[model samples]
Target chain A: MTYCLGMLLKDGLVMISDSRTNAGLDHIAVFRKMTIWNEPGDRVIVIAAAGNLAITQEVIHFLHVGVTLPDEEEPKTIMSVTSMFEAAQLVGAAVRRSYRIDGERLEKENSGFNCSFLIGGQVGGDKARLFQVYSAGNFIESTADTCYFQIGEMKYGKPILDRALSYDTKLTQAGKLALISMDSTLRSNLSVGLPLDMAVYHRDSLELGMHRQFDEHDPYFAEISQRWSKSLKDAFLALPDPSW
Target chain B: MTYCLGMLLKDGLVMISDSRTNAGLDHIAVFRKMTIWNEPGDRVIVIAAAGNLAITQEVIHFLHVGVTLPDEEEPKTIMSVTSMFEAAQLVGAAVRRSYRIDGERLEKENSGFNCSFLIGGQVGGDKARLFQVYSAGNFIESTADTCYFQIGEMKYGKPILDRALSYDTKLTQAGKLALISMDSTLRSNLSVGLPLDMAVYHRDSLELGMHRQFDEHDPYFAEISQRWSKSLKDAFLALPDPSW
Candidate 1:
């Protein structure tokens, strides 16, 4: 399993994905799940995927090749989409291509041809945007009411994000929030492991700014992991234990 | 969907179940999911269930009417089983019976003849114990390394228990931990709603004690809910912001 989340904030968009995939407990492997399509200063589209690794990689491959959505004048790939919305459509088309290729065989085996993607970023003329594309090739964009989208092993990491994130949160604080959320996911679920991929996008910068990979040995992640665990324990201990 | 948990500890047993059940989001209803079978001074058995409400109710009824397991004695009911292990077997027998009656019809409709139960408590000459009974009527007892079992909407509420619960935790502390776990579930999941039914049994006491129901208006529950949420937010704030 994997966990991927994207948030479209006032500052821009933040995206994170875990890099572990397991067909079963014995088949666990590491595969980076984040892909960046960038033409610095023109457009920067980031996609974080979860579900079948093969399906997600195929979707990205389809996106890198040419595809056209209805009403578009040209065959546009992720790198050519004029706005974040078109970029989302391009991603959805890719997912559809994967479905066409593997859906029947996967269904016969009782293995779903399932994959979902968190696509977010900005083009030269549009504001930052984020979307969650489903296995069916349809997608939903995030708005003020729903500023974040999570796919995969989402439940273990959700309470913190539900309580902490908002569209106006500062980028640095949002980065911390995202890490703590990842930290919670890491501790509760063995299916979701590291090295985690994170991208912190600043508003209106049509370029991917900060991207990092975190493993067990990464110092900053090590500090965040140790510190967050200690903080949770300390906070829990500090709660007034009920006498009743 | 539902969420129920049972924990076996040195002080005795702790079991908690949410009241909500939903066939679908629009078809949600509330029903008590806990059943207590006690011979007072001889034994105390608690079964908390999740999955199809009808199936669970039928299993409870079967146990009440005495489902005989493949054993050396006359059909022993939960109240008469000498060891906690055998009592779990009695519950498992009921699960199998219910499945035999309805499994095929449910499968035809694409719904699982699905149900599971967490059974625990001390019986006459035995130490406290916990077991998870599957839809197939097979069961697994909780080991020292894994002292708790949860069914239904479990993930959102699991991190706290993973971090805090152990075989040696006091009954009172276990109760607090259970409540906090339930609180997290109630907050994040609409499918796992209140009022909650919780029971704490003392080891070898063969009696159920300390039972409570927490609803939206319950005073102590309201206090714990507010305080826990505050602590989480406060803890998040206390973490340093990312610099890079």
Candidate 2:
């Protein structure tokens, strides 16, 4: 299981991903689920994927090497795309390429070719956009009403984002919300662990302002985790313990 | 969809269930998910069901009507059971009866005969026990270590329970926690709605207390929901905002 979230706020895009993947509890590994493509000042795209690591990696590989469309003679890659939409299309096309190759074999073996990505970036002149790209190679863009997308182990961390987030939220605030969300998920699920890859992109800056790694002992996160737990308990105690 | 949770604490049992049942979002109804069989001073059993309304209704009806186990010619039921374990078996047997009659037909129709129940109560000298009876009719008792069971739309409300609950929690406190859990779920899911049925049974006390229906305007619940939401927001805002 994994938890990845991408927020497209007025100030910027906030991306957070937990770096734990497991075939089973005993087979756990620290697999970074986040991928960043940066041509600083020109384009910066961050993609976080969860589900079927093989399929996700293959899609990324396809994106890296480029893929020729079903009827087209030439290949289009993320690096070669003109718009963020085109970049999303290229990523989706790569997913399709992976489907064409191993999807059937996986199904034959009773394994799903499951994968999804949260893609966000700015290219050339258009404002930054964020999308949730699905395993089927289709995607949906985030609008003002829905300024965020979460993939994998989503439910456990969703309430906070649903209640507190909006496009106008400050980048730092959005990052804090994202961490709080992640903290909730990590506390509830063992499948999602730390050594988080968090990147905060300032809308038109096209540069990652804060791309940091967080482990179990990361001071700020530890403080937030401990503090959040204490705050919640304190809050629970502060509530009138039912008079029933 | 539904959301029901049963927690067995050192002080007692906390059971909460939402009454919203929907064949689809277009076909919604308020069918209470909770039922209680209390023969004061003798036994008390609370059952909460989720999934396949028809199947759940049939199972409950079977329990309501009592069942004669094969080879044991007597028709024993929750009211007749002398121990919580036997009461759980009666509930399980009721589920199996529903399966025996309609499972195949539903399977043929591609609609799963799925339903689960949380059965918790005390009978005679047996301490209060909580069992999560699955669709297969097999059940697992809630031990001190794993003290809670949730069926349907559970994740959204899981974090608070994971953090705030312990075996020693008072019945009223557990009830408050359950309501808070339900409040979180209601905010996140439209399918799980109001008019929740909450039952908090203290150990050794066969009579039910604080059994209430929390509708849109139910005053006590209104206070709980409002205060709880405000506290969460206050706590969230109080958490250190990101420095980056």
Q: Model 1: clashing residue pairs? A: A11-A203
Please give the lDDT score at residue A144 for candidate 1: 86
Among all candidates shown, the one with the greatest lDDT: 2
What lDDT does the true structure give each of the candidates? 0.85, 0.88
Write model 2 residue lDDT over B10-122, tens digit each, in one string. Answer: 98888999999988779999999999987888888899999999988888888878987556778987677778888888888888888889999999999988899999988
lDDT of 1 by residue, A85-139 (tens): 8888888887776787899999999998888999998899998889999999899
Worst 10 residues of 1 chain A by lDDT: A235-244
DockQ category of candidate 2: medium
> Candidate 1 residues B140-161, lDDT tens each?
9897789899999999889888
Q: Per-residue CA lDDT of candidate 2, range A142-198, in tens?
A: 998889999999988888777778788888888888898999999899999998999
Off by over 4 Å in 1: A71-74, B71-73
Task: DockQ for every model, please.
Answer: 0.66, 0.73
TM-score of each: 0.97, 0.97
Question: What's the C-alpha lDDT at position A126 in model 2?
Answer: 80
